[model samples]
Target: MAAANSVWISLLVSIIIVILFIQAVPTAHSQNDEDQLIWAKRVVSGNQVITNLQFYFHDVVGGRNPSAIRIAEAPQTKNSTTFFGSLMMIDDALTVGPDPASKPVGRARGMYGSAGQTDFGLIMALSYVFSDGIYDGSSFSMLSINPATETVREMAVVGGTGLFRMARGYAIARTYWLNAATGDAIVGYNVTILTYV
Candidate 1:
């Protein structure tokens, strides 16, 4: 009886050891892990829109690459009209002229002729190529601005070339100043984006 009892005790101890071992070993489905196995977000997964990006646009003849010799040179259509192509410089404040007195950070070059049949002459779609700061090689289009809603304008990010190839996004712009005399404007923008390279 003593031997039998000892044998039984040994078996019980062995079973307890097995149970403890199983619990101690890490299991894929265990809920006791300090950290779970998961994939992390990639670095290029997100980018922020640089806010308060300022620019000054001077509506002058030959201002754009296509060259709007004059405002009348703009296309006049029943459903749309074209405005002069404009060149602007990105600055830090509400600038008015092409020659920025101060706070010039980058330069913008591209076509900005307006089109579409919108009674608001100021209301039209514009495309401009950005050549400074993080906007290098990327061009964004102010698809259209409703004078009624000119307080906030959305610029469509068309595809880019080179470093900015396959760019997709939009820019939020607020007009800081508008000169009725020359059709010049000071605009501010905020952009958020992501790129592969």
Candidate 2:
């Protein structure tokens, strides 16, 4: 009886350990997802629309190369537009700079462009090449638009030629979020364009 009781206690302890491990694994994964969502929400709320975006370099090993780029955009209610208005502009250069005078230039149009077309022209121009978990190339400047005035404003630069150029393809992953109040029609259409230069 004593031996049998000891064996049962050991089995119960093992089962408890397994249960704890299973629970901990998911909590760790959830933490990462939570961080991503928080960052996405912050990008959606900040002013200077398209306020802050960043890129990081991953050390390469052997013959393998690694890098990443993170692109974020924040469109405030003030910049929100009607279903028929323009949302952003993409130029041929890294336009957004520390100085307000150094912003890039691009034609302004609606999110879907004229006639309700999917204008991935900006993403195409920036993403010159796409490969397995890697995007090799460079892109120009990106500009944001003011829905009210329809004027182009310097929002942020994805990949510039100078110091900013090093940030190309630094973000290996991306996440996008839209305000809950903004109906799915308009929310799903808004995008932040980044170059994998």
Candidate 3:
């Protein structure tokens, strides 16, 4: 009878301790919770601003200090008609004009790979880092497949930082100049971005 009473008393104390612990622990809706895992609230919408930018991309692949360089490639990349599987790292210049001596605006830094086996398609993942005028310290990112032979190519401006926060839009690229011997080129970009003001 004494042992049974002791067991009952111990069990009752354990239940009380568990109950106190549960009450001490914070729940999702606890009022005194300083840290929370989830939150939801409504925010005002339709405060987007559209910005249009134009610039020239100078891809210097032939000079002693080339801006773009081939980093990796498949065994058949050199002989492949489309240069498929070839990857190149680029830190090309963004200028106000097509001329290489034009005013410097920014840099196009990224990697592009020839991904198409039959077509001259390049998968580009580039960031346009700006340091001129209103877009100073701002950068926009692009990830798209560019059909190299197309007269005009369209690329998505997925996101951005600084002044272009939450940016989304498109960019149009056109060949401004090319050197057949050196494989150098100046490409013009017209980008339209919609960002949160």
Best candidate, lDDT: 3
Off by over 4 Å in 2: 1-87, 90-159, 165-167, 183-197
lDDT of 3 by residue, 1-197 (tens): 99999878876865565455434432223323323311111122245455667678998889799999999999999899898999999999997666677667899999999999999999999999998767778999999999877989999999999977888989888988889788799997877676775
Best by TM-score: 3
**lDDT head-to-head 2 vs 3, winner:** 3
lDDT, each prediction: 0.41, 0.26, 0.78
Q: What is the lDDT of candidate 2?
A: 0.26
Q: TM-score rank, highest first?
A: 3, 1, 2
- The CA lDDT at 71 in model 1 is 33
- Report how far off residue 89 is in candidate 3 (Å): 0.4
Model 1 scores worst on lDDT over the 10 consecutive residues at 37-46
TM-score of each: 0.45, 0.18, 0.75
Please give me the total number of clashing residue pairs in predicted model 3: 0
Positional deviation of 173 in candidate 3, in angstroms?
A: 0.4
lDDT of 1 by residue, 22-66 (tens): 344322222233233110111231232221223444333323432
